[model samples]
Target: MEFDTPVLDNHLHLDPENGRGMEAVQDFARSGGTHLLVVNKPSWTLGIDVDEPADFRAAFETTIDIVDEASELLGGRAWPVLGVHPGLVSHLTERGFTPDEAGELMQAGLDIATEYVPSEALALKSGRPHYDISADVWDASNRVLQHALALGAENDCAVQLHTEASEDLTEIADWATERDLPAHRVVKHYAGGRLVGPMPSVMSEKDRLAEAAERGEPFLMETDFIDDPERPGAVLGPKTVPRRVRWLLDEGFDDAVRTAHVETPRRVYGIETLG
Candidate 1:
């Protein structure tokens, strides 16, 4: 199907298991996908901690190294968005890395990642979740975010942020704005704010998207809901993606919805889709 606008995918995960590594991205571009923002969320990707592995530092180091390799492989076709996930924040803290050290580690990761990943793929402040209780933790989280923003500015890439709770999105917007980046440039994901409780019925997704549009804010929609007889909440049938896309399109806000799902994300991360 032909879309009126460029179909940039704001949220895409790199599953090492897929074997495409970074090379598969080229295929996405050929299919008329304009851009892709590859996000590395440990819990979602590795099913383990970012700080895990016998070689903690190496685990972090290797992620960037692979990303850098992928960047070079995908070239302009893909961009990288790297960060320490909030769920993994506690894990990093327990390792006794100061906020400064954590920020430094992230930078090193980006440096190596970009070598393989496109320079257009940039560093992002990821992993800040709401369940974190320490006010001081926010300070650490902010430090990481600030560092990523600075790096992003230097490289001319946008930052992707994930807030644990939906209520915190406004604050996140404020932070991004303070960094001199457009609020829209601060891409968010996972329906991180959408699956609040119980089952997420279709109407819930509709209401949230409507609210975000009314406020002129970008909304995140996901196609990765995994359905399981044992764990029904995990599956996202393929039908869901086009359904949600159709909903936004039917609402007559096709441009805005398309941007959130594709264009804005591509512009921010520096990714091009391959067919």
Candidate 2:
């Protein structure tokens, strides 16, 4: 299936667990996937203890290497989304690190991300339903989240948030509004039909997506493709987003396609795709 216009996949992971990262990029391109953002999976997902300095450094170095490689492999169609995942805060606290200590570690990760990723695509991923983080841990997560946002504001980049679409999202947007980076600077990473912030990169069914498109704000689209070998397209297939775009086109949702896939992503990430 080919697309008349380029399709942007807003979120994905392209490590070995994701299956031939370079090859996957090439395949996505052939399917008319012009742009994508690859995120570093949280430590809990990878079973690595990131509180350890060596592990943290090595993990981040490896993540940056993949992001760079993916960018090169796709000829700039790919960008890296790096920052401390909120889930890491949950994991660290479980491992007996104090909330403040976990927060400090996340701040260090953000510092490292700024050093490695020279753009606004730094992620402040937090608050997924899966993690049972304590209140103090949640506070720690917010501290790091604020730090990550500060980094994005300073760098003039977008912050991809892996948070639930709830009142907390409103607070995040309000917080950004008060800061140098406005609400749109926060890309609600893996969203659905229900919009919460000024910017939402959605991942939902066609009907719900159509509803979001009708509102006509600049909302992007993503498959949130996990790419875990064991879970094999747990969220969605690598080609799912592009195919969804095709569905939109076939269904005569051209404006929707342009807004979600082409324009919105380019606006947030500062990258262009084929028309």
Candidate 3:
């Protein structure tokens, strides 16, 4: 299926050493995808033990390299979103660091990530864990999240969140407002439905996409493709976004396709073109 507007996958990770890497991207391109927000995988995924903030550089650089390669392959259709993955707190604590120490390290990592913004990277990625945790860890995570929001505001870019599933995010929205980052610029990755605060990057599920489209509000689409060979197609396949856009077109939701694939992303990421 041919699309007049750009087809974007808002959240994706590629690991050449451990996963399909460019082969997965090729599948997306073959299925009509034009643009990607290539997010940084967790530092642990790259076998990095983050004892200090500088340890994040390797993972961020790897993501940036992937973005560059993807752009070269697709003619400037990729952008890097780099930051410390929120789950790093648990990993750090498990490695003997206290919760507060973990939080401080994560914030410092985000500070380094901010240095690449509006240059090597287009946005930041950070959020609290989506699973059960102790109170101290949760508080630390929120601190990191607040810092991410402030950094996004300072850098004039978006912050893609990997957070717990919730029907409303008014608290997060309020935090963004407090930090001077526009609510729309705070994207909720892997969203299952339309959310109240941050912009929902709805997973490419037909029913959820259809429901989000029905609202006609500004939102983005994503596959959250982890690109892990061990768990192939964990969240969704890389080609899912383009294929779902095709489904939306077939269902006569042309406006939704335009909003999800082009308009919303352009506004949120501040990208001039998806091509």
Candidate 4:
């Protein structure tokens, strides 16, 4: 079987602490990769010594700085997707913060078109969705998402999100449709079997993808895979990645998967399209 080299890596991380850096990224690209989406987390959220308040803030700032600098330095070579991760949100709650406050802050990140979402409450209870925040929290989250949509429109940034289920994305899709926002403006990230649940339902990933296809909704393909094994989370298996792409191809939806992962993300970040 023949395969194509990626013009871009739609989702990626580069951290010195994690042992991923410029060299590693370059090698990946040289081996037929052209672009990368560098995923960064705020330093405060970095899993360093979160035992102290100072450590937390440092990690947070570091993440912000990394995004800014990488955007400038990488230029057409790499792009960025910013967000406070769901896992990090859980960690913050364990450290201390009212659920309402946590939800509010998470929305603030969303408002700016941050790349990820707080899938659920701390302790990582993702099995139980948390769309039912307090009224105030819901309003706040809505306002932020609205602002994010506007920013994404202006900057050509795609809003990368992680949801407890596909239904959680309906409102976003509706909003985009109501406003006539471009399909490529929003790229649902970490979308797969993980958050979509183990059973078929209205909220399943397949249902969501079919809906998106019918409505021309755009979505970037992301593995949401991590290095950890003990955690019941989205694991990006190298072998699985190509297989998923192949599956989409077989489904007659290869263009969506390729365009989302390659064209849309690069265009948003002002990078060259992969040939």
Candidate No. with top lDDT: 3
- lDDT by residue (1-275, candidate 4, tens digit) is 22463534455445545544444444443343444455554434245634333333343445445444444433235444554454434544656755555555554544433222221100000111245544544454455455555555544445544444453455665665455455444545555422221111111245454554444444444434332333424444323334444555578876666665566555544445554
How close is every model to the real structure, measured as TM-score? 0.62, 0.88, 0.98, 0.56
Tens digit per residue, CA lDDT, model 1, 143-215: 6666555555555555665555454456555665676665555655555334322111122256666755555
lDDT for residue 184 in candidate 1, whole number 0-100: 55
Global lDDT of model 4: 0.44
TM-score of 3: 0.98
TM-score sort, best first: 3, 2, 1, 4
- Enumerate residue pairs that collide in model 2: 120-157, 120-158
Q: Which regions of candidate 2 deviate over 4 angstroms?
A: 17-20, 44-47, 52-54, 71-76, 119-132
lDDT of 2 by residue, 158-221 (tens): 8888775542378877777767787887887767666765588787567668877777777888
Give the alpha-carbon lDDT of every model: 0.49, 0.70, 0.91, 0.44
